[model samples]
Target: MDWSTKRKLEYFGILVAAILLFVVLPFFIFIYKPPTCFDGKKNSDETGVDCGGSCRLLCRAEALDPILKWDPRIFRVSLGVYSLLAYVENPNVSAGVRSAPYIFRIYDKEGLLILERRGSTFIPRGKTFAVFDGNFSLEERIPAKATFEWGELVWSRTTVSGPEISITNKALMREETTPRVEATVENKSLEPIRDLELTALIFDSDGNAIASSRTFLEYLDKGGEAEVVFTWPQPFPTRAEVCAAPVDVTLVLDRSGSMDDLGANPPQPLTDVKNAAVYFVNLLHEKDQAAVVSFATEAASPIESVLGRNFEAVKRAIERIAIRETDIQHTNIADGLLKAKEELVSSRHASAASQVAILLTDGVATRPEKGGDPGYPETYAQQVANDMRQSRIALFTIGLGKNVNESFLRSIASSSEEFFLTPTAKELRGVYKKIAEKICTTRAAVIEIIPRIYPR
Candidate 1:
């Protein structure tokens, strides 16, 4: 406990502390690492373990959700095999998912879940894509509806655009028997491309994806080309409407004096007839051609002599046909029939399109007098109707009001179903609507195979 002994002990302790601070502490500081985004720790201000807060990778809660761009599509490949396709969208501009887990559930007609398909797919950067699952056997269970679901996706920034390739010369053949698609794929990039994948989609006339198949080409040299083929083991169902054919129809209307016998301000039956004719013309398909023919003392193609696809022009022509005060008292049914027949026969698509003639009359045919009285107008009209049918033109005749001769109007039609008698002008619109719908429904069935190459 003397001063010399105490001083010596303190000196020794100070020497040891100085050595530790300079040597051991310096070594530890040199090996130390600051908190980072990829360090797999939450030391820094990161939201998750190693994500968010200045990291290229975002946390699950920070990333925006992917969108289901379209409803899932299901197609039967064979007896029990089905193909499922789900169109997806990544709204982020520079962020994407490398691989994401997803689920597909198929439901029966009773709304019971029948199948659950689990799979994983890589979502590319900055685009809408497709995730497809195929060759699923329902085993006699038919799917009434299919749903697509997915869990949290790990998103990170990526600008990689995979495999610069182009598709060309696509051809779909043997659609009625065995459907097969033949196409060529070529690499446009200077570097070699590997594992090129492609998906094929067949859309119907309504642009709905009906059938799908996927094909792959393992590798391609720089600027190299190869042929890719996709085939369907089963043919598509033909009962569904693939195409709706255009129709060529001529609307024949009577503008005789008795048409306005109800004596309204704008004329009862005549005004209603014009409105019904416009409604009927509007109901026709956008590609259908229509012509207007009206008859009072004489039949005339008022605005246009030729059939045209311009439905507005056809409506205008029908509206212009009026029983004006200057018009004389006569109904030339024969001329109306002949004018309509002429328009239909000379139309541009006479052979390809469905031909039809709708005749509306309010009184008996009493024009073309032989001795200044009235000729055999009824006989001429009947003969023209028969001739119209011989040209494969379906005829529909409408008798308006109580004054019309039902027997004469019926004779002008091809069959009893084509004849309609309306006791009041108010009922005429409904009759015209019925005929318009019939014309649209009876459009000849056409087959078409649409091929689309979706890029990934």
Candidate 2:
């Protein structure tokens, strides 16, 4: 064959091949299936229907397209950890479709599949429809850009329902450290969440899913409380401030005759107690609250001092304690400690960092008038100390005079180490100074460290 004849024959073959490829390639490249609601959107005569088009994407076999339409795709979402949520619009026709099950899926930033779920609904006739509550973890190493796709939504002539789903995640701070988070889940729907499977996904600073927990429970009701707690799997880069409770302090003063003695030192023994108590009160932070109680024959009072933004008010209350004894009979240490504890525990701010009762005495408890009498000074101090302990109020005792019963004082304090037995009146001021230091040194939060391979 000649060169021109060969070229003409080759060109004819190329034209036929191009025509065939154009017809078949598009069929695979894009799907052009009829809208799920196509038939339903039309009239009885099968006309005037808002079938597949950009204007509206639904049509029904039975019902005609109403001027106004209801959006069939509806859903709600919740979170168990920090997560990302989104939605997508169906880009298909609008006929014979009542509702279509919206398949929700989560993908990592790298386009890896993480989770998927299909909502319940039948595609009905409408101009517009929407799918909601597409949720994924913020912990999933999200790439710069991520995408979402719905599963094949089918048209169903019968009724279909949607599933109740939720997504939760831990909050991440600027440093990308996992935040301490607590979650509560309640079954507010009419139906019970049977065999509910819940998992909490915790993320790291780099947006990676690091830790997870599966929670199991019998059942959750409308008003039920299911508390789930999660912490960072790795230690935070920097330590955060710990939250400590406030302090509840009750000052118990000695009002016996010996308390009236002037100390060899510049400040009298009683004055030292007053000075120490006032200084401690002055040191109280905005979070700390204090009260005063004094005893002579019996514990006479729990005088409430106004809560101090600063310590000035507390000092005023302490200095105002009456030097006059309620009764000149004898010291009733037990009555005083007990009365002080009762008042402290009943206080609104009782459950604080340091729950303390400070007992100051310049003399021993009243000696027993009768062997079996329960009102003896030793018996009263012991009984009161024991009773205060049962109430969980920690006691710090201050003994001022040489005659002060060291052993008896030990028994009244919550802990022997917390008790202070000053051998002479000269040491009373130092005792108060020490007490103030102890109260202020209390830590903000209860911290007990347990060694672990990796913290979670």
Candidate 3:
């Protein structure tokens, strides 16, 4: 209790502490350091190698890989310039990566790798974010396919919520010349949104993405709106000839004795002809009207009394067609042409629609019996075709077999190029599809609409 005794005891305690720091502690540390999360090894309370249990690196198995809502896509921005984009989905709640490395491989029609784009992006949390690379030039090569791959990913814990932006008043225009997609991007949140990137995708009526463009928004005040327009320097590209105008087409098919020359009961070329006609009908635009006009000894409307937008009905009518089994079964090309012209001029046909008649025959016109002239049927068919052509009816004539008079068929077509020659029944579908593309295929639209934002 005295001052001197207390001083002596204090000095002894100080000596013991110095020995532990300089000697005892060093001995224990030199022998072995206890397992820690920072050791880069799976030890201690960690679940996987240096991950979880107070580690910054998250366990890869516990994380969800981003989804590919669609494959990588390319859109032409100008003559040879293109924009590459893909939608990556990160659904992990309250988690994201600071930087994500990605690679996109663009392939041509032959499946050869034409271009490879590599970039890094911030993985926005719990949303479909876009990976975009602009100003990519493929010169004259057209991209037919693209593939995406992810690089080494290191996910960390974080929270991210994208800017509240809404797209409205979307309109697509100038698709035939230079494609344009305009839309208003409005910031819906009270806070101003900064560094926003917008993408517009043009979709065809069939919902297939045909085009895409990228734009940047540096900043937008809360409740502010900005009109963004996407323009492509070139008119949309199509693999086949397409009609931009509305169409009203009639399939004037021959259901005569020659069509069933194979004697298969259901028929050979006729059966194939029906299938081709149905394919053509199914390819028509939603507003387009199709009529089935079949002729043996005389023309008849297989659809009974209507030519409208009901393509399935028209297809059914074409399927129901069979070769006329009557004793006077004859190929009446003139009657078929007349019947098609009548159907095209019907009230069911839209006033603005382009009137087209696809005339297919497997044999020479044998009707309107030439008592004196063997060429009478051909002359009569050409006269009827001339009348229809003068009435503004475009004709596409198909000579389906060796028996068909190619010269007469060519004369029936509105133009020489409108004539198609099919050497076999199996080749009819391709011919029909080509014709359908001429009248029915729509312009390319954007592939998808995905907006990504960067807050920092």
Identify the superior model by TM-score, candidate 2 or candidate 3: 3
From the highest TM-score down, the ranking of the candidates is 1, 3, 2
Q: Who is ahead in lDDT, 1 or 3?
A: 3
Per-residue CA lDDT of candidate 2, range 255-317, in tens? 666766674333366676787677666555566777777777766644545322346766676
Q: Against the correct fold, how does model 2 do in TM-score?
A: 0.41
Error of 3 at 399 (Å): 23
lDDT of 1 at 442: 42
Q: Model 1, which residues run further than 4 Å from truth?
A: 1-22, 26-31, 40-48, 239-456
Clashes of 3: 7
Please give the range of 10 consecutive residues that has the lowest summed lDDT in model 1: 444-453
Judged by lDDT relative to the true structure, which candidate is superior, 1 or 2? 1
Q: Which digits, one per residue and each the tens of the lDDT, describe model 1 over residues 15-62?
A: 999988998889889998888888889867788888887777888887
- Model 3: ten consecutive residues of lowest lDDT: 440-449
| lDDT value, residue 334 of candidate 1 | 86
**Residue-level lDDT for 316 in candidate 3:** 79
The C-alpha lDDT values of all candidates are: 0.79, 0.53, 0.80
Clashing residue pairs, backbone N/CA/C < 3 A, model 1 = none
Compared with the true structure, what per-residue lDDT tens digits does model 3 show for residues 1-456? 999999999999999999999999999889987788677789977889888766766789867999998877777778878888787789887677778899999998899999899988878778777787888789999888889899988877665456687887776677678767788889998889888878766665654556677888888999999988777787766532234668888888888878878757668878878887777776777777877888888888444435788887877788888765558588889989888888888878899888999999988988878788988888888898888888898899999978888988998899898899989988988998888777654543434446677648
Best by TM-score: 1
